[model samples]
Target: MEVKNKVIWITGASSGIGKSLALLAGQKGARLILSGRNTARLIEVQNALPNPECAHILPMDLGDIESLQECVRQALGFFDGIDILVNNAGISQRSLIADTHMEVYERLIQVNYLGTVALSKALLPHFTEAQSGHFVVVTSLMGKFGSPWRSGYCGAKHALHGFFDVLRMEHQKDNIAVTLVCPGFVNTDVARNALTGDGSAQTRQDQATARGMDPGRFAQKMLRAIEKRKMEVYIGGKEVSGVYMKRFFPRLLHKLVLRSKVV
Candidate 1:
């Protein structure tokens, strides 16, 4: 809903889409709790906000699911409780399944899927007690359609859709909302930091990702979707068409994905 005066907790707030969201939310007068593993970068983002005083930094590692509840407690203590929790912290994969190590998959799942789940569960009690809260998930277009070199990434994102859909259904009575924001290819370092077969960062940007929508613009669209409490929203360029293709013409989408130079 309206962001003004609302307490919003955003993960991955150091850079990329999360940073963009923090900036935009700050402009909208929302009190923010910014979370990420990079303390310096988080502080940098906070300082860049229009109202840095209204923002709190909470450095956290989403991969560490066991510590998430404690993180949640700290976040709640920041401003009594968070009115919205944005699940935006995640890692990506850039290798074929056959070539990827099991640890790579585990890493992706731990950060992208289980991490989101753990944090959401930790915050669920608060949301239920208040009976008013929003969970905004930043997933991917690949969550809906399979891709060339993002098997583990796709799996993790797809799992988010499943879990959040059920969460929305089960929590409807509590007036808690779930919004899944599926971004196709955003212009960010996600590809550069993507995990490879050996679990090392890809350290290279993808052509398509480099040419994707600007994170600032994407965040604006994302906030609009959250305001409307949409169940799912897709943000990107032509790659967004892939989601619809998968819905009505899976075979065509499959063929197109096979022919496209994803990385």
Candidate 2:
């Protein structure tokens, strides 16, 4: 679908891929509702938009699931109806599974999986009534092929595939589209904001992430997928082939994954 003049709500819009998408959508003449955890950073993004008047800032924390409905309501009050909802707000993980605490897993699921589902459910009725809406989910390649030191993050992203797969089938009659986007490591602040076992943000970015694709380029690719209304899209460097490897050679792929440079 053409994005121009469409009202889109993108979470995690303060920086990285979300920020890039918001600015690109603005240039495409789309009205935007940009959300993120940091109010100051979100406002900074809004300030940089070429069409700032078309972008609305909404500071949100998926952890606060209970209040998300109110947040959605406030966002909706500004526009007629959202043409697309980009479920991009999520936390990353780093640490061996054995070393990870139960609390860490709980927080990861709460933010990455449960919160995303809750917000989608809350918005379901509106989409059903309108009979025209799209859900663009930004899960990781980890969701398809797991790597080391991110047990909880992998699990949460994996869950989204199952849940959204079912949702796509169930809601097809309603004209509600679900596009699951699985991205490989892209150069972004995600690594810096990843949570450690102790629930603190990791201060340093990973080496691989620092050298990953530019956020602007990634966003351009993603917009094409959205425009094509693709059911799923896997994006990344050659490592992205690991997904196909797993499908064709599970046992051998498992061994290869065990020795992956990502670890």
Candidate 3:
């Protein structure tokens, strides 16, 4: 559907892909409710929008699952209604399973999977009543295939696919759409912000991630997929081929990932 005049709520809007999506969607004339943990950064994004008046800042921590229902309530109040909810707030992993702490896994699951599910569930009745809404999930290619140094990240992302796929099946009658946008790798602070062995931020960029697709370019592709209401779309460079390789040539994909400099 055309995004012009649509009310779009985007999570993790402070920077990276979410920030790009918010800016582009605003430029397209979509009203926005930008949510993130950083209030200052969220305000910065708001001011950067083409029509700042059309955008609202709602700072939230996705990892705090209990607050999401209230957060959704506040978000809906911003625009009276929401046409799309983009689940883009998530963390990445950059540690081996053997060294990673269980707390790290829990944090990843809380923010990346359960938090998204809870927020979506809280907004379900609204979408049901409207009989029209879209759920844009920014999952990762890791959700589809495994890679070294990202076991927890992979697990959490994979769970999102399972949950959202079922959600689509159950909510189709409500005229609700689900679009799972799987990004292979994008030039973002994801690596730098990734959780390491003890649940601390890695604070360093990965070589592969440094050369990934631009966040703006990736956002453009993602918005197109959302407009088309695609069930799923993978965005990235050559790493995108890994999805097919994992499906048609699992052994080869496994070998390739093992050989690659994942970090």
Q: Which stretches of candidate 2 lie over 4 Å from their true place?
A: none
Candidate 3 per-residue lDDT over residues 163-241, each given as its tens digit: 9999999999999999999998799999999999999999999999999999999999999999999999999999999
lDDT of 2 by residue, 101-175 (tens): 899999999999999999888888899999989999999999998888888999999999999999999999999
RMSD of each: 0.6, 0.9, 0.6
Give the winner by TM-score: 2 or 3.
3
Best by lDDT: 3
List the candidate numbers ranked by lDDT, top first. Answer: 3, 1, 2
> What lDDT score is found at residue 239 in candidate 3?
91
Q: Which 10 consecutive positions of candidate 2 have the poorest summed lDDT?
A: 254-263
Clashing residue pairs in candidate 1 are none
Q: lDDT of each prediction vs. the true structure?
A: 0.94, 0.90, 0.95
Report the CA-based lDDT of candidate 2 relative to the real structure.
0.90
What range of 10 consecutive residues in model 3 has the weakest lDDT sum? 71-80
